[model samples]
Target: MRLIKRLLPAFSMAVASAAYPVEWSGNLAVEVRTFPSTAQWPEQKDNGLSLSFQPELRHRWNDGDQAFTFIPFVRVDSMDEERTHADIRELKYLHVADGWEVRAGIDKVFWGVTESQHLVDIVNQTDLIENIDGEDKLGQPMVRVTRVLEDGAIDLFLLPWFRERTFPGAEGRLRTPLVVDTDQARYESDAEQKHLDYALRWNQTIGAVDAALSWFDGTARDPELLPGTKGSESILIPYYPQLRQAGLEFQYTGEAWLWKLEAVHRDTEQEDYRAAVGGFEYTFVGIHDTPLDLGVLSEYHYDSRRLAANSPLQDDLFIGTRLTFNDTQSSEVLAGGIFDLDHAGKSFRVEASRRIGQSYKLSLEGQLFSDIASHDPLAAFAADDFIRIELTRYF
Candidate 1:
C-alpha cells in the first residue's frame, strides 16, 4: 500500500509539476454495444454501455531534443465490471542526439504488417481486458537505445519489470468458465516477476521493401492456461515461463499492391514452435468513374503446433475487402473473414468509421463466429456475436 501510494504521485506529475508546465490534449467517448442474444455463459447481458476519457500531457525543453510525455486513460462500463479500468498509456522521457537516441520509462512499441494478426510484435503485453483481439497494449517500462545507420536503425532494449496480462472478470462475456487468478499465478523462473528481459531489433528500408529482424530473451509476456481443482469447483491459472524468440517482419509497398509477412519462432520451457502469416493487398482507385476505392486482401496462417492450438486459425485463410468513400468526412469501411482449411469453422468482422461535423467522430465494429466445430475452442462462443458503436469528441 505504501509503495503504491508513493508511485501514484510520481505518475500524477501533471498536477504536481510547477517547474515544467504541462500541455494537455485527448478524447472523451461513449460507446454502446448490443449482443442481440444471451451468451452461452451466465451473468452476461444482451446490451451494454461504456464511457471513456483519455488525456495526454507533455512537457518539452532543450529545443525539442528532450521531452516527457504522459497519457492517462480511464473507462467505465454499465454492465461489465471487468471492462472498467484505468491505465497510463505513456510515461516516458526521450532524448535525441546526432544519429542516436535514448528513451527511458513507460512506453509502447509496435511491429508487424498483417491486418488480422500480429505475430512478430512482442514488445508490450496485451491489455486483454480492454479488447479480446489483443490489439490494445499496456505501457511497458524500459530503457531503450537506438543507433542510426546509413541504411537502417538498430535498437536495444533493457526491460527491468514485467506486466501481467489483464483478464475479463466473472461477469464479463467471452470469458472462460472459471475466472483466472492473475495475482496467484505461478512462474517457472526463480526470479518470478523480477526477471529482466532483453531485446534487439534492426530495421531498414530498401527501395519499396521495408523489413526488420528482432530477437528477444527472458520472461515471456504470454501465459499458458492451467486448470486446477478446488474443494468442489475448478479454476484456471496462468503460468508464465522464460523464453527466447526470433522474429521477422517485412512489407513491400508498390503502386497498387502491398505484400506483408510476419514470422516468429519461440522456444519456451514447455514447447518449441514457429508461426507465420503472409498476405497481400491490391487496391483499385476511382472504380467505375466514381471517387470510391476498393481494396482486396488475402492471407494465410500456419503454425508448427497445429491441432494442439486453441485458435481456429492454426491453418486458415483470410480474405477481406476495404472501401473508401473519399469524401469530405473521410469515411472508410473494412469487411473480412477467416476460414479454417482443415476444420469447419469461420469468423467474420466489419469495421467502419467517419468524422462527424468538426469535432466528433463515429465508429462501428462487429464480429461473428460461425460454422464452428465442437473441437474448436471458440465453439462455445458461437452465440457471442456482437456489434459496437462509439462516438468521440476531440478538443
Candidate 2:
C-alpha cells in the first residue's frame, strides 16, 4: 500500500508534464438497462437495472513538422455493484515523428471487420451490454512502433499480459449455469503459470483501399476440471497454457461510404480447439442531411472439438443506424439476429439510445432467443430478454 501511494503521485506528475503543450478537453456518458424473464425461461426474470458512467480526457501535443495529434481517452467507469466495479479504460501516450510513430500504454486495438461481432475485441469498455457481461480480456500493457514506407507501414507490438474469464452474460447481470463440465470455474494464481503475448502487423494502402494483417501469439495459465463432476465427467479450471491467433483485415474508406472485411483463425492446444471467424461491414453516411448512417455486419464462426462437434457453424446479422442531432447529441437504433445456420435456433436483439448531452444519455436494449425446430440440445433453453433505463453523469 505504501508503494502504491508513492507511485500514484509520480504517475500523475508525469502525465501532467506530458500534457504541458496542450489544452484540456473531455466528455462524459451514462447508461442503464433492465431484463425480464420470459415463459421459456421463467426461472430467470426481473434482472435488476445496471448503471454506468465514463468520463474521458484528452490533451493535444504540438510538435513542429508533425500534425497536431490529440490523445483522447476514458479515465474510469463507476458501476453500481461488485459486478460493475471501476476499471481502467484507456491510458495512451503517443509520439509522431517524420515517418515513425510510437504509442505506449493501454488503448482499444481494433483489428476486425464486423461492426457488432468482434473476433478481436481485446480492450474492454463499459456500455449497456458490457456492464452486464464483463469483458473477456483485461487491459494489456503494451508498446507499439510503426514505420511508414512509400505506400504502407510496418507495425510491431509487445504486450505484457493478463488473463480474464468470460462470463455467461453481461458483467453485472445474472449468469446461467454452466451446461458443460468443461467450463472454467475460477482463475488460478499459481507461480508456475506463464503469461505473455506478442504481435506483429502490416498496414498498406493501395489507391483508395487500405489493408492490414496481424499475427498474435500468447500463453495463459488455465485450469481443467477433474473427474466426478456433476453434469459431465470433468470440468476445466483456469489453468495456464499457450494461445495463438492470426488475423487479416481490409477496408475501403471512401468519401461517403466505407467497406471492411476481416478473418481470424485461433488455436488453443490446451483446450484442444481451433476456431475461425470471417466478417464484413459497410456504412453509408450523410443521408438527407440528417447524417443517416446505415451499417450491416455479419459473422461466420466454426469450432472444432466440442460435444456437438458436427454442428460447428454459427452466423449473425446486425442492421443499425445513427442519426446525429445537432452537435452534442445523437440517436442510434440497431437490430440484430443470430442463427445457427446448421442447427434450429435464432436470437434477436433491438437497441435504441439518445444522447442528451456530453455527460448524460438514455437507452433501451433487449434480446430474445427462440428455438425454431426440434429444439437442438443447445437450444433447449427458452427465450430470455431484458429492458434497461439509466441516467449517468461523468467527472
TM-score of 2: 0.68
TM-score of each: 0.92, 0.68
TM-score of 1: 0.92
lDDT of 1: 0.87
Q: Kindly list the per-residue Cα lDDT of model 1 for residues 227-331, writing each as its tens digit.
A: 975556677788889989999999999999999999999999788999999999999999999999999999999988888975556899999999999999999
Question: Cα lDDT for residue 74, model 2?
Answer: 36
Please provide, for model 2 over 1-395, each residue's C-alpha lDDT reduced to its tens digit, 9 standing for 90 to 100: 99999999989988876766444444444444444544343333344544443445455446432322333323222322334444455567778888998877875465655554555543232232253322333444577788988899887877765535433332233332322232443333342323446778888889878887878776432223233355543323434345566777777777655666666555666444454455555555565666566665555564554334423243333344434333346677777776766565676767676766665567676767667455353343344455655554444
Residue ranges of candidate 2 with Cα displaced over 4 Å: 1-30, 38-45, 57-81, 121-137, 166-174, 178-194, 220-236, 252-259, 270-328, 357-359, 372-383, 392-395
Model 1 lDDT at residue 257 = 98
- What are the clash counts of all predictions, listed in order? 0, 24
For all the candidates, what are their Cα RMSDs to the real structure? Answer: 5.1, 7.0
